[model samples]
Target: MLLQRRALLGATAVLAAPSLARAQAPSWAARYPELVFAIIPSENASGVTERYGPFVNYLSRRLGTRVTLRIANDYAAVIEGQRAGNIHIASYGPSSFARALMTGAQITAFAIETNLDGTKGYYSVFYVKADSPYQRVEGLRGKNLGLVDPNSTSGNNVPRFALNKMGINPEQFFGRVVYTGSHENAVIALGQGTVDMAANWWNDEQESNLLRMERKGMVRAADFRIIFKSDQIVNSPVAYLNTLPDELKAAIRTAVLEVHRADEAAFNRIYEGKQGPLEAVDNAAYEPIIELNRFVDNLRRRG
Candidate 1:
């Protein structure tokens, strides 16, 4: 059944090719001086800004187009910016991307942070402390679980999807649940024993960061173990305003995707203090997320 679904999704991709082609074509128009990219505050504004400001500046100089990193205080603020068409591009987590596009935003590219040569998806990890007797999610059957947020792709949707597949319904699976608001908070909640298990998005880059922190005594990886992982979906994508001109959109895409190979330093800076370089991606890549949203929404309505 999974393979058949994949085939159907592939067919959808092919069927949508013409429309995508039309969207890709360039138009004759003056380029904008500044491209405002809204970033979700994954951490506190000060921490993220201190880490990422230099990267945006690097992008500004490299593209010869000013790139300003606008931090949204929360997810609602981010979505509002999309609705206003003031945001040019943004890196939205998979589920967040679905909500934004579903409500009326246009996604143009996805970020490729993984080292895999061709893959662009990430996992949703269910983590518990190392010493916890809980070995699997089933053990937490009636315990509190920490979810990153309702709109988080890997944080909420993936975990719910996995739970449902296992013949468990998340709404009733856990005794109680709470939203941590950020992945970092979810991790901390699990560490402090405030929650029996924490749900979050885990990628190679994130794993490495956690390990680095562990090594530095910030947190210990040995203290936590992954009990679950969900089917991969396209990583958070960079979305654009739906009303943007074709030419201007193409130029913006070209600048971000094409310029990376030639300027490594500038590209890496966008990752802030951690990773390096982002790969080019498109809207078609997020089909699974779109499908998931539709499926989940229907399930909710039926309930």
Candidate 2:
């Protein structure tokens, strides 16, 4: 009887071992049932969805979790969401990402957009209507100027840095400065003659606001003239909240890096790239923007 009881006890222990291991195992889905992916509203919300829906769906499949795209109303909304841990992943403009870091947002950049030539940066450009008398930054003096957003690197920071380097203070140089709210709207404002001049991003290739607008019939490239263009500012970055588990973060990075391989056309269109893959990035990539931000802040305080 004693031998039979001992054998039965051993079998019971073996049966319970797998269940115990299953209970102790980590479950990413249980910890994070869903992730909120936020994008800066460089364009309208609907446009963002239309442009990124497929990419987001791909990410959801890759991560084996639900990924919802959240179109932020403005740059600050994205920054604040990440800061509050509400946004798990975000695509941020250079200046906005710098601001997020400067303000203590717990996030880390894992990927950045790249061009076909493997270049990972773009430029900031100042534009005026082709027929406008303004031929240069100086020509726009005393005229209304449109800036996309304060936190926008291409639309605001880079433009301010370039103008300051040229000894041109936008506030004092222009009759009035207007925030058009987005790069797309800034272009629209310039085309509609709402603002005499506007600052935005230009890749100098097929990937630029001008080209995007031209493709959509919103504005003709011939209808606008580039007055000034700044040197290469790194393209926007894709970041994940730091609070995420290490395993999940690694998976997220791997998924994004492989996205181009899975669907090159969709990836290129989503990022406005020239058929290039997403590349790994770090905070060091944005050191220039950090310095630029400091310079702009000083200029603002003095002004």
Candidate 3:
């Protein structure tokens, strides 16, 4: 009888363990039950899914909830998704994130990407065909320019800011301008000679949209030459809607900052270990981008 009682008691405790864990889940998690995480469209949707699959799975496990993955077709969609509270979490370029706030999207930036050297910035670069006679931005005047997306930071915003500083209005300078809709598409347009020049993001010689495309054999790095490189812009950031419960927000931020520590291989796959892990960040870090956006807005007004 004594042995049977002891065995029963042990079984009860074992069964209760799961209950305790469930109780620790965020108060709001009960209401949400599932969360939607959206990723900015830096690349194709299929590739985005393959790259983010493990990371999203890790987030689900860490948060003790079902986290669904959604790849945004454009930065505007991500911003709109968050604004409408349809997306619980989403990543954005610095300028895109800034645009969200400027346009009243009630979101908070929680984590920022970093360079391999631990710098929290990247650059906007102009790409032209290597054999093209044009060697400078001036030479490309009256030529078609490919901007990634209207909301893209390094893609359109920073590149335009750089041009405005050069006393050239993109609308009046370029024979024509087209938004290729993505970094990959910008290069695609350039490679196909659809556009004489394209603006894209570059972190370093080891990592860039060009290198990513090269790996897929879509374009040869040697075939393109970077004609202009803008000053380092703030790295992209992951953000959450402000409407979420504080506890949920904290958990999401903690989970993001510890992603590399929790699953180094998954995190490494995202950046190929060429970049550092995500770091804690907030709205203040993006003020410069907000200012930049404002400046760009003023330019539009002047134009």
Which one wins on TM-score? 3
Encode model 1's per-residue lDDT on 45-79: one tens digit a residue.
55456555655665555444556677765565566
RMSD of each: 10.0, 13.5, 11.8
Report how far off residue 114 is in candidate 1 (Å).
4.1
Better of 1 and 2 by lDDT: 2
Q: Which portions of model 1 miss their true places by more than 4 Å?
A: 1-33, 63-65, 110-116, 204-209, 212-217, 245-247, 258-263, 269-277
Listed in order, each prediction's TM-score against the native is 0.79, 0.89, 0.91
Which structure is stronger by lDDT: 2 or 3?
3
Which one wins by lDDT: 1 or 3? 3
TM-score pick, better of 1 and 3: 3
Candidate 2's TM-score reads: 0.89
Question: lDDT values of the candidates?
Answer: 0.65, 0.82, 0.84
- TM-score ranking from best candidate downward: 3, 2, 1
Ranking by lDDT: 3, 2, 1
lDDT of 2 by residue, 77-129 (tens): 78888888988999999999998888888899999988788898899998899
- Please give, for residues 23-102, the per-residue lDDT of candidate 3 as tens digits: 56667866877788887788877777778877887787777777778877677878777877888998899998998888
